[model samples]
Target: MVDRVAARAHETIDRVAAKAGPAVEKLRESASTYREQLHAKADRLGALEEQWIDSARSYVREHPFTSLAVAAVAGMVIAKIFSSSHHR
Candidate 1:
């Protein structure tokens, strides 16, 4: 009778473990997918940052004063927008 009870207890433990194994596997799979996605996005952002740097260098080389003027105007516009928004 003691052996039978021990066998049933082990069977119940095995069943619970079997159910938990799939849930743990699913969590690991989702974490892997999310990690991969984040890495891909970081790579894309790196490429975009390099492109923007190249563009800015080229723009500065071509037109220093024009770039400054445009930047100032845009900054003023943005500030004005933000100031107006805050007032509301």
Candidate 2:
């Protein structure tokens, strides 16, 4: 009787595993697809960032004095914001 019960338990486990196999495979394929999509998006974003950096560099080269003035004003504004936040 004990042997029969053990055999039956093993059969049940095997059946459950067999039923689950396809679902697990589907989930794995979906995860792989999502990973590929995420990687593609990251690559595109990296390229866009590089493009923006190059554009900014070109702008600064064309207008060095304007860029310097903008940088000074931006720095002062940022410093003021931080100083006020610290006081609060």
lDDT of predicted model 1 = 0.99
Among these predicted structures, which one has the highest TM-score? 2
Which residue pairs collide, candidate 2? none
* Tens digit of per-residue lDDT, candidate 1, span 13-36: 999999999999999999999999
Candidate 2 regions with alpha-carbon error over 4 angstroms: none
TM-score of 2: 0.91
lDDT to native, each model: 0.99, 0.99
Q: Model 2, range 1-88, lDDT digits (tens) per residue? A: 9999999999999999998999999999999999999999999999999999999999999999999999999999999999999998
